[model samples]
Target chain A: MDAAFSEALIALLPNLRRFALSLTRRPDQADDLVQITVERAIAGAGSYDPDQRFEPWLFRIMRNAFIDQTRRRKTAGTQVDIHEMPEALPTDPGPGLEARLMLDSVRVAMAELPEGQREILHLVCVEEMSYAETARVLEIPVGTVMSRLSRARLALSEKLGIE
Target chain B: MQIDDETLMALADGELDPARADELRRLVARDPALQARLHRFEETRRLLAGLRLAPEGEDPLAAMIRGAVTPEAPALPPPANLNRPPWVALAASLAVAVLGLGWWQWSGRAPDGFAPAELAALDGLPSGEVRRLESGEELAMIASFRDGDGALCREYETSGGDLVRVVLACRDDGAWQQRFAAVTKADGGEYRPASGEGSIDEALAAIGAQGPLSLEEEEAVLRK
Candidate 1:
């Protein structure tokens, strides 16, 4: 493998972990998902078109790997309880008490969102992927990305009491 | 203007074109309700952005991937060798700029930059023909085309030792000058030469290359 590909992949570890966490909702499962995604990406590196953005390609791989893992777990009857999963939010000491409380409410609100809406929201908002890029990663059309994102944002606002 | 939620969200997300966004901005400026609706999308994104995972130290998983891919063989050139002459460094930077990879090994000024066999292959072989030299290096001319300046250029692949390099050269002042080149280790299977046009297209765009010439067009151009 080329150093460029290796470096690029390494640089994206945090983003991959974040995306994986958003998908699997458990840190441990997210790590496992990231591992599988990286392995598949390296193995199938030949198929990656250089003209395309690397983030979408790698994110697509991670999403597909998550789907595979979910399927296998469903077959084995070992799915984790979504409600029991730990909060994926960070407890940054930098924020003041009031800001932290606001962040906590946002986290809880985000957790209550439907899986599809939450994933799209995290991909677009947290990861800062463009709508088109998010669509590619989620394997949906641009219209769906916009619509789903709009719903998620609206839902989030309702929960937060934002004007 | 009765802008829907999708368009409003798209505007807040910076996905809408400038003209539409400007129009929306004007409307929202005058309408408090419209501003409030737009604020919802913006506020949600802001809160979500605040939840981004803080950057951490080197992940062990990344270390594992790095170790697995890097073999004992020196697949990449040493840092010292990259201190090329200014013109070559400029060309190399252009290669890096286009490819986003520091794999271009464009040695300056042939007779030394190119092997005699490589030069012969480019001159004598037609596009889509492969020739193996006595030295055992396999050279394949993939395609030929004219740059936006109408300069004749050829894309070729050469594999020898453990590295495969794809190069684009344009004929200038009766001599073919290397414009772009990317080298990758042959064993990794990371780069497939036949599928390298995507990367080459960026280089072609950098040089403003027109589409590849048909074989007949290439032949007629070569005869001129």
Candidate 2:
């Protein structure tokens, strides 16, 4: 985690944060997830192969961290209060308020999606990770990626009144 | 020919081979249903693109992170016994997973009880400092950041001999409040440093982030 590596992680932070937010559904948790992922990435930096795309490798760590964290929280019964909800992504509020509202509606709908589908949608649709890359990041089969992605899109479309 | 949702999705994502994609394009030129399905897929992609959070407010946590990730920063030790069966587990993950709580933290601050020295651990000092107190307890700052609600928190530990307390604390109204903590003794009466995933990571995920501290914000935290 030298300056160069820190710079590299910073450059990817926005995307990494975005992916984490999608998974965590809140900026704060996303930030923490990003922090934890960076910790795991930096700690496991020695294990990273320079040949692989760093993004997926980093994503894998976040996914694993999410799993590890989620399992523990379930056991502990910690309650995240209303204050912990993620702020909607800031959009131009003037002319785009209605559009933003509609988008907010979609965000609400996305939040309703099953964790698996939501994750697939975020990776494939939001981050635009290839289905192949997605499978690798999620440690799922490629076919499962396509099926889950299809379901996520259909569900979102239905919820958003897009038919 | 009936177009399956999967094929339409592939066409929209440009995942099909060029030959098949070109053929579909020709079909879509004439087939109203195919065109509608493709439009649906494209629109879904567009709507979902809004999922990315815009950096609007000051990310008060950025600087702490920037300070923390340096090569000089304490590395999160690789989980001990990764290959070993899961003996040690996290405290609570439901705060992040089961409740499915969307991101947002309540306004105002909660009360906390830890001493000032303990509270300072949340200030994002680069890790790896091993400070030994007069009591012969070793206190270390593993990492720091503000949770989703903007409260500063630290993943830290205090150790003396056979007993080690791994703790996660967040500053609530300027005092350290412990959200999660656990103590585990070394197996067979031998003391080894603790390493691996624990309550801290789980607690933070549930806590959420307002944003990372911007460099200036980190400076401000340091100034305080």
Candidate 3:
């Protein structure tokens, strides 16, 4: 139990929370996800290789926690009705009323994306991960990451009506 | 040749070789529809970047940390100072709301403004070592040789405020290359050199005090 591990975890909390929220959509669930991730990280601290970067390792844990939660929900026969979930806002609010409208539209469009596409979109595009890193995090092949990202972009362009 | 999605993604991520990229650029120049599609792909990436993380009010990380540290703590406590006047209570509630809003705005939750290029630059370093230096720190060169780690990691901070972290990993080829380097906000919001002498001497001294590097020792961890 190195003291610096706790400090590092604290520094990473904000980004972890954001990533969890994007994955879970619900605040309570996102918090739960983060909690589980922290516990797992703490328990497996010894397994953390010092050579690799910490953020990605932590992020991989967070992603696993999210997937595990989803799997548990599925096993319990609890299906999430995404239609009832609240939406995420625009990154930039821009000006006034127009900005608000744009945000609403963006939120709706984001909500309509499939979970797999949305996850890749958030990780690669929003988080700015390289394809190789994204593949490592998602446990998928690099080609899959490329194709998924391309599909996600195409869908978003259609939904946003971007020429 | 019109680039496929794979090639386009690689190009957009700057993963393509210069010659390949040049060939793609030539193709895009001659193809209107392909160019339009490429533009759309780029715009889509920008729009995704514009998708802000959920606002601060819903931060689960705080709750997660609290829960992990104090699993048996009580969930809620009785209201304190309940005898205050109604107006005071109202003001207090408003104040709490305002403080919450302000915290969300400034809680270091927003992006740290480190661009992908910066991260890429750090990744390009040889030893996988980088550091954040404090401003106005004395130029220092500290080399710590830990028993178990093969080569010594050299760290230093420049007067110009760059903190540099470097590890000389012994490769199979028996050559040492600079591994990791990053430019981050220093103690006074200045650049910290990743290695060398001057202001970074203090850190080097500390590492030197620790011991010499050994074959089994581990290098310092790099944080993004």
DockQ of predicted candidate 1: 0.32
Quick one: ranking by TM-score, best first? Answer: 1, 2, 3
Tens-place lDDT per residue, model 2, B1-224, is: 87788888988887899999999899999988788778878888888877665555535434434553433423443321222111112111111122121111211123234444555545544344456545567777555557877776656666666555566677778666777665544322211334234444466677783323434454466557
Candidate RMSDs in Å, in order, are 15.5, 14.8, 23.2
Q: Cα deviation in Å at residue A3, candidate 2? A: 2.2
Tens digits of lDDT, candidate 1, B90-151: 12222222333344333232322667888786676778778996667687787787888889
Off by over 4 Å in 1: A78-89, B70-224
Model 3: how far residue A3 lies from native, Å: 3.9
Q: Which scores higher on lDDT, 1 or 3?
A: 1
Task: Summing lDDT over every window of 10 consecutive residues in candidate 2 chain B, give the lowest-scoring window.
Answer: B99-108
Q: RMSD in Å for candidate 2, one decimal?
A: 14.8
lDDT of 2 at A68: 72
Candidate 3: where is the Cα deviation over 4 Å? Answer: A75-100, B53-224
Which is better, 2 or 3, measured by DockQ? Answer: 2
Ranking by DockQ: 1, 2, 3
Task: Categorize the docking of model 1.
Answer: acceptable
